[model samples]
Target: MERPIDFSRDRRMLCGICAHQWLVDLEWIDRWEQSREVCPGCGTTCEHENAPRVTVDPDDLALDDDKIAQLAWYHTSTLPDWPTRDFDPAADLTPETRRMMGGSKRVAAWAARQRGKALHVGTYESAIHNMLRRMRDQADHGSQFYLYRVLLMPSVVVREGWLIDPGNFVGDVVLDEVCPPGVDVARYLNYHEDPGGLSLALGRGAVAGVQQVAVPLRDACNNDWVREAVADLDGASDALVPATGRLGRFMRPSSPRAFLGRELGAALAGKLPVNLQDQFASAAAFDEGDNPMRWARRTSCLFDLIVVPLRALAELDRQERRTV
Candidate 1:
């Protein structure tokens, strides 16, 4: 079977007339070689060579050299070769990491300043959770190790945004037959229950011949997904909350009272007080207890912050639909 085109990762040809880059999705390259496709950017029908614009490479969109140098400084200043080390919980952040972190806090703010678009690029935590979920869907048909990793690692990542290809990232084997009827999708979606089955499905994929490749943590900040987002914003604005703890800090209330309305906060917090003083006065205070509900509320707050801005953007589309 032919590989499907990934709009996010695949390169697209640039049209000479309008300078718009478009992916070739529906037809074969050989067929395209014989007959050109229409340029989506401009209504120009031209051969690939006559188009005058080359495909845009995702790698070129990586973080600029200065940003990379900054990360390198952080990496070298703290550890001799921090980029090579696997993420470890017991490790301490070097001054460089702290500085990189400070920069991350500005992503959302910067994103907001963009002219007409707003996006929540999300923290590494969200990315990792997304990856784990992806792994649950794609990993070997029955790997116990992968199962525990998916279940336990949601809250444990030291950093995130490492580029791991979801397609080739894991799997010793596909155990489609081993999965009970109707149980496959449910296992991962409703993972709070029997994730073991998902793990079991993934276990076969963890075999010796299977290899999982991951882009370095240092490059996580430079991933194509983020760079493309920034580019699409067209210098409008942006901010970043690099981690969940800082995400909580960014959502913290300024005054003694809870900004999130007493009732809503109380409800989200379960029986716990909805006071900002307790929840976001400081990092230490918020991390004080292992109360799962407290963590859930924090996660919910972050999720809401990530989504509320997009509501207006969605509204714009709705208005356009009505006009059309």
Candidate 2:
């Protein structure tokens, strides 16, 4: 089990040279309260001005059963005829589509189980948080998206090369945040509305040639129904990233006949890379009522599940390097 750490009782500091920001544990709070601390990214005794006061704690993290239900509903939208309830066996699932969902119904079943529980908000939050950690652990072994892609389409990702692109062959893309490494999912989910933390958890580096694009919800199509469904199974709250109405809008109302589907086709056809930053820009331009930053956060969380495999890959690389 992963131990819970205190995010509060700390100050966040930024390295001016590397633009790397990190949290300084409370142990150093008084020692450096009057001065700056050495940065991990770039070794420098950052000045006091470079550090800012911020608070992050378990109380800050929120995930509940209702949001989980809505997310599960979104996942149901990804399927053609799956029952959109708390739990589904997917008995109606077609073999062709089943293969696309990584050939495992465990994730869907897991979501159902989570939803079925009558746990308190904190309980749900802690459960989901731990699940995310476990998912991260599994990703390191290349068991996430890479494994599924290989099983379904063996010739997609390049076996070996300096220029590694995960979605090169079919736009084989995965949804990811545009925010730099070190920004915690909480910060992003919260839209960085707070004063900002002193320290950020560094991001696992992305693969070379792998592009992080954000497709506007209006332009995004449900290419792989199963993949989208699976993603929805482990979704966060729309309220957490309150910008757009709901994260589901980005890929719902299946576009089986739209010309737009040609570009954003199912996970298998992966073609065009959506520019998330630009998509948010355009949405903000016309969404006279919604907050663009909030919309970005919602969008980020909506697609957060899609990047697990990539994150796993990054973690594995970090581990291998440590051993070397």
Candidate 3:
């Protein structure tokens, strides 16, 4: 059994030069104060005295069954028939079929291999981001998208180290365990080969009963506004440095889809100014009224199952027609 470390005591440190952030235990910070340490992000020797440090409060790190029940979680997909409530990671795919799967299916299989069998869900923003990402990558010209609002059972056991600073949690690595001596870290640490840690919770029954409601967005991928925004973002991202050699088969170490989703989400939220802001205006308004963020914020934990009424679905279709 792994020993539980108190995350409330962890201190978040940021590297001034690279802007890389990481979480370290109190002991690690104490040692760093005595002697400067090498930054994992940029390999620069950072002086502890000048580095930014913030200790996490106990309340901020608190997660329990009650808290899990209170918050809404979500998952998004382009596949209309994709399983929502009872997710079997291995499902119908065999080893051969798993290898043959492409796009999100392939990613899902890979996640199951890395993180074991559990339904993956996150905050409302994450769900919207995921939907946009799928539309940008996998959706057809007339493809629709589904947004699922997931309700976790009050008895759900959420894994620790995931709720706060998830990027650091996911990116945490032991060089010796993952990379062989004299081998390039980039070669092994890219998306395809990295050993993920989510299995620590998923494989242990962290999720029990789950209920979900699917909201269909018709012709979402075909919306002219969405197309313009996606095109603009894709062009910008493609100009960045590309991965080389064998690793090119996978993807960038930095997950570009997530980055694009965040950028697009921010743009939609009016938090960022983009060249296509005018084009995205109508879509942004539609998003504001009928989005995962709004739904997640409005509902309470009392409802065991929530479904969108037919009138609401009609309203969504009407909204889409107006936006388009």
Candidate 4:
């Protein structure tokens, strides 16, 4: 079993430098939620500040039963047919993408390797946080549009590289406060709003566009009906960096769609769609004002039974382990 350690136990978080030195039992996650943990050294607010948090452990999961039933109802009734997809860590990704996925945290990577040997599974946050450990590489890999393009964002970037400078890809991209190292990203994303109203940041003192592009995702498209159910599952998988809105749960209606287009028809709102408003109207439907997140408790139950055990990452061989 993975032992829970206090976040600030050894690491002293320096606000100005964004660097952390390991200490003991600091458990500073909640401290960041209330306010930014300042550095004892130079006293500048960090652009990024966070305490790592992972998926609720199965033993520690908090969902109830009724909500699980609702998720099942949506699966049987509302979800559109989809197909199966598979997760392959060895799959070639852009240099930047791997960086976002924490392709290089020695500790986290070591944990992953151990899992393969022991057939152990990782909580989603555990897998991704470890990948993002390379804070210094952000700029060399990408910038603001990188934040916009969650699709290709790198997991690891240098403090200087955090935001791609304003230029070819987009505009000046940077971090409002650099959380440097020892900052917890999961806790940060869940805690305070992005600096200056920017939900995502970039290079030092720079960022790309104000309008962030969201991806199109819905219950019908998910549920993996198009392919083998779990094969195509993206929401909760450690390998795939989940898009926004994971506070609820992954892979369900709780997560917002990429845009407020087809589903919530502009026809009802009286705004006309420039292209194929009719078609989009036919497609986008809230169905009911049911917050899918409420069903997360229930969906989690079914998912634990269906998806969790089937993940084969723990079964990788020595060669595969080395590659990951």
Q: All models: lDDT?
A: 0.27, 0.28, 0.38, 0.25
When summed lDDT is taken over every stretch of 10 residues in candidate 3, the lowest stretch is 188-197
Please write out the lDDT profile of model 2 over residues 1-324, one tens digit for every residue: 111222223445545566776676544543454455455675555364543333333233223212221221011011222222334446567777677765666647644543432111112122222223333332321112211000011111211111112222321122232222332111112112112211111111211111112112223323444344334422422232322466665743332222222222233212112212222222222122233333334333323323322432233233311100
Query: lDDT rank, highest first?
Result: 3, 2, 1, 4
- Predictions: Cα RMSD each: 24.7, 21.6, 15.8, 20.5
Candidate 1 lDDT, tens digit per residue, 22-73?
5543232223434554566665654545552334244431122222111100
Give per-residue CA lDDT, model 4, range 1-324, as digits (tens): 122321112222223243433221223433443456544444433344433222112222113222211111000111121100122333455668667767767445644443222111123222222112211123211111101111111232323212211112321222223334532111112111111111122221111111121112113133422233223222332222344565636543432322222123333312321212232233323223323342222222222222332221221111111111
Clashing pairs in 3: none
Which regions in candidate 4 have their CA more than 4 angstroms from the true location? 1-20, 23-27, 33-36, 47-324
TM-score of each: 0.19, 0.19, 0.35, 0.20
Regions more than 4 Å wrong, model 1: 1-19, 22-39, 42-63, 71-324
Runs in model 3 with CA error above 4 Å? 1-13, 16-66, 79-117, 139-142, 163-324
